[model samples]
Target: MKKKRHLKKEAKIFLIGLGLLIFIIIVILIIPKKEKVLMPLFVGLKKEDAIEFCKLNNCKVDISYEYNIDFEKDEIIKQNKEKNSELKDNEKIEIVISKGINYQVYSDNNVNELGRIPVMMYHGIIDKKSEETSYTGGNVDKDGYQRTYEAFINDLEFYYKSGYRMIRLADYINGKIDCELGKSPIVLTFDDGLSNSIKVTGLDEKGNIIIDPHSAVGILESFKKKYPDFKVTATFFLNGGLFNQKEYNDKIIDWMIKNGYDIGNHTYSHADLTTTTEEETIKEVGRMYKLLKSKTNKFVNIVALPYGTPYKSTHANFKHVLSGTYEGESYQTDCTLRVGWESDYSPFSESFNPQFVKRIRAYDNDGNDFDITYNFKYLETRRYISDGNPNTVVVKNENVEKVTPTNLKIIGY
Candidate 1:
């Protein structure tokens, strides 16, 4: 009897141990596991790299950008979590990105913040004089669409002396003006992408292109050297021909973009949008955009309308010009240009509509009817003068109502 009792006790102990092992397994399966990882060093990395790391590590990321001098733009300047710190996979981390010394300040008090800005439009820049051509007196065509090389130089001098600094058309449309204090922002745009605009001659010994010194790009580079603070830049609206240099087209485009110039869509064939159906319009705009993207990744989503057709947005195919898809790829533009004759409103103004931006004809007409001279004279008291602070829009007390509601702080004096 004693021997039987001993065996029962041993079996009871074995069953209890098995039940405990099963209970432990069940508990482990039911309870959630706490997963953790050490935060990697994120500071000094590019913002994109840090975000990508977070995306793979199952961590949440918050980012903010600020003007930083020490760090390059888009580089991570700071991080909330330290390197090697234990963090739950779901924890959030905040990072600050550098905007690369984009801040400026000035104490001038005479800025006219609620005024118009000039978007100057130019075409072919020929190395000819009036005596060489049977056109008007100035170095321009009779219609003034083309300006002589000498006349173009004179125009640059006029703009610099008149306190106008060059800004990209894209920046102006986006309201990101970055000129000096008391200076007005001026946008330079060249249409047609003519040979004279950027003529690439034979390559040099170093295989670098030899741009004709009198070409539009050559003159602008020389002027930029003379007036470094002018921030001399222009947007060249190009068709598929691309400055008409079939062999050196890609090289010229790459050079322009690397040198801080902008390229925009002028349609694949310079198709007049008003004459085309909706599908045709999309193809024209989209094909040019796609072609540019294929050449360089830095495609500016702005189009200079061919002949400035469909001048209003009410046209049936106008929306297609703004955004559309062609052959499976989609394209969108932020603003459209007209063969305009006057200055456009300040982007901060309630009257500003990026859908249709006007431009001034950069030609000589004896100061007549919306030409360069006439427009500058008209803008003397009505120019959008910089307040030296891009984060705020300061205007006269009477113009407060004209300020557009924005995230930017609005102040009226």
Candidate 2:
């Protein structure tokens, strides 16, 4: 009887052990295994940019290490998975970052390759006294402003008359065709959509705005009439916040697109993008891109810095990228192209250097005088005559003293 009882106990123990082993195996198979995914790291991205990247990749991040970057800090150096890999949900994605470099030293020696490109800027048309007197920085005198219109017509007329073809910015960048050097290869651009851009109060008999147009449509229409074949186009960098406001301008942006012109990105609120906080900077720059993208389904990669200056700390003597919220402030050191004025277009002088860019202000009726390059010369001569010092002396009862005029210049005649 005792031996039989011991055998029963052994059998029960064996069964219990077998049941536990089966349960363990089932548990192992039931739980799902996680899959691996790819996270790409660009050469010049920061921690914030990483986060944005993660957001794009579905909230999976596992940073691995950092590298020393002499030029840009917090930039991404590497990623865990190689490019074009399928990442599973919740899988860890490791990436490497870089320690930044001194921006000031870089700016002094650094140059932007794209800076070779020339850009022309302009304010409003000098139409009213209130508008003409409003010319502050880079003053486009009323007559000189008018000459820009005349120059446009003349440029189109010349192009049409001479059979010179016009091309867009992308055409030059993509190397569509080699330009004939010293043969007047140029890019025409304007900044800020002012009210004067649409008005046509001072146009010539050729239906050209002797004064600059106050509207976008007006400018395009005028250009179309004069040089339909040359395909004259201008880039209008917009302040997204100001588009619908009563004081802000641009009723013709849509018209320009429908009529075959391109639009580029300008910061959201026209803030000095260099000094703004990372979040705000991202919001500002990103917002404009988003707005334009949503409306036009177009991607805008070009940017024009407001105030045409870099952040105080950015040390941007020329143009450089700021730390973006999406991509830390990695200045585009490789770029060389920046936009500015080529010359003072008002008075005709042989002293103009096209390399040194000049901007214009188009406002009032007087701007009509500057409708053509020759018109520019005429206005300059007139300005010289009006501003020339007259040799008139005040007679005093006491001993007379020799006096010179405050605005005197050498008399030629």
Candidate 3:
């Protein structure tokens, strides 16, 4: 009986050991397995290439763009991920791309800009249109070689209303084409140094000096106030006697220059260079240069030929028309003005030439085709429109590129 009990106990021990072995095998089978490293590093690759590369590495990509002059378009400018960085599979990497140069629209008020500018010339301002005396002569189509005061005032109003802003000759030449806000640069030049041009005569009831409201200065000042955008400056090409017999000599020149106006030489006696000898030319230009300097103590470097003649006589010296030594001052002109009846190119334009600058004659009721009004009507479409942005340069858009950004925003002159 004892032998049979021992056998049962041995059997129970064997069964328990087999069950524990099965439990150990089941636990090992249910546990998860360790995975291999799948992360990859990506940098300095093109966006498309990088994306594909990331995909190969089981990663993702995100993008953004910004204007850059130094980088080509779509050329990967920057990437958020470090080169050879350990990125997890399906992880997103951010990248930045170059967009070239950017731009903002120039706003419009009454002002506009042009690739070229038109310079208008006025000779004198006529105070009375009803004056009976009529004088006719060379280059003079009528009795009075000027615009009537009322008409002159009206012209200023018209131009100002039409978005024209007067500018100094120096400003134009220096590429300072942008003037007051919402206005275009237009040059106003008065040929003869008529006493009445900048003079103020008579007095109001308050004893205030009453400026003739129709005169050039009067009209400019008044119009400037009315529009507040028109620049109150002009170039007065002075001739012999410098407003001869005018009570205010130095005072007038000083006042004009002080007030932003500029003066230029028109010869000592209005002698035509085409008819004068080389020696005579020097004397004419030289003497006047000295005289103007003594009067205003400023550089008199510009010349308006007497009778609209050439700087050099047809039969005289062959030097540059703008070159000369007047009074040991090396009075070389910065630019010369022509007695013109046509509109001129913008000073800022690449095609503009300082030597052959033209001007348009002021218009009146006389009905001459060459008058300012006539030419203005003919050249209306050519007027400049100031694009609000002064920094942008106007140029052709055909050759535009990312690195070479141009100022030209709008088309047409």
Candidate 4:
């Protein structure tokens, strides 16, 4: 009887062990195993090929893009994983694709390649008609320094259609022409900081000063909304009376800076540098600089000469205009602008000088010489056509010698 009982116990133990083994096999079969994959060389491959490889390996692909001068568009520039490395199925393989040569080339007929840039000078933006006002085209003054609101709007539209983009004066001096491909860069500058230039009517619910829709800045903002790519911006050269709005002066200046517009030194009291003595010039330039620095933290170190006097560098007080001290505060100027009647040279040109810049008056003269109509007609073949890359200076093969020597790559075609 003892032998039979021991045999029954052994059978029961064998059945329990067999059941446990079957359960283990079922669990192993139910759970999916992750398949390992050997990463292939994806760098330098075409983006499509890399994606195909990822699909074949049962992996996912995440693509990023960057502008590259060396790699062609859609070519793989870099990969996240190392070549021949181990990866799990469905793992992401991040890759960067090239955007093809950072610069674009336009047909020779479409682009002039490093020609002149137009730096237009403006004053007031009034809302009167030429018949009502003594000035032409509803300008505020007989000199045509102040442009009428309607004419100003028309000018902006003309510029937009003509393929001209607005750039800051500071950027122009720094040789940073950041416009679209094949488009020319133009600058708009408002002198005198008139009440109509950036009029602040009142405050909104949020306490933001309301910009008059009929004002110059207001018109610019409206035009910017109409054409998103217009890049409408201008530099407002201010005197001691910032925009002539004592109540909203601070807020207006702050808003202008916060926006894309810039503020430059128009000299305190608008003193003409030619007639002023060296000390007066220093005080004029310095006092304005100090006032602007106090008003805003980002004051542009540029001065637009009042009345465009002292046109030549030989003026005795010219150095003082460039740099001077006022009441223990020393100030310096990057460039001085003249009330010019012609467009300035390209920043990359050998003749370019930031210290002295020229401007074309924004006025109507029935297409007379030196007017916008005549100048632009002349610039049809002479305007600076961008190569779409700021880092490189593209020009005609013969004009290569005219390019200023710098770290910027020069390409002649």
**Top lDDT prediction, candidate number:** 1
Best by TM-score: 4
Residue 6, model 3: lDDT of 100
Q: What's the TM for model 4?
A: 0.80
Off by over 4 Å in 1: 1-109, 137-139
lDDT of 1 at 234: 95
Q: What clash count does candidate 1 reach?
A: 0
Candidate models: Cα lDDT each: 0.87, 0.44, 0.64, 0.86
- Give all TM-scores, in the order shown: 0.74, 0.41, 0.64, 0.80
The better candidate by lDDT, 2 or 3, is 3
Q: Give the C-alpha miss distance for residue 211 in model 2, angstroms.
A: 16
In the order shown, the candidates' Cα RMSDs to the true structure are 12.2, 22.7, 12.8, 5.1
Model 2, range 1-413, lDDT digits (tens) per residue?
Answer: 99999999999999999999999999889988755545554556676776776786676676655434332567677776777677766566777777543233323422111112223344443433332443422234633333234333434455445323344443333323223311222345455544455443443575433333534445556767765555666655666743343422233444456555656566678777557765666676667666666556433355556665452333542222332333332222111123333223211122322222243233223334323333333333221111101221111212122222222221111
The TM-score between candidate 3 and the true structure equals 0.64
Query: How much is the lDDT of residue 380 in candidate 3?
Result: 63
**Candidate order (TM-score):** 4, 1, 3, 2
Instruction: State the displacement of the C-alpha of residue 185, model 1, in Å, after optimal TM-score superposition.
Output: 0.5
lDDT of 3 at 58: 72
Question: How far does residue 198 in candidate 1 sit from its true spot (Å)?
Answer: 0.9
How accurate locally is residue 311 in candidate 3, as Cα lDDT from 0 to 100? 38
Clashes of each: 0, 48, 14, 2
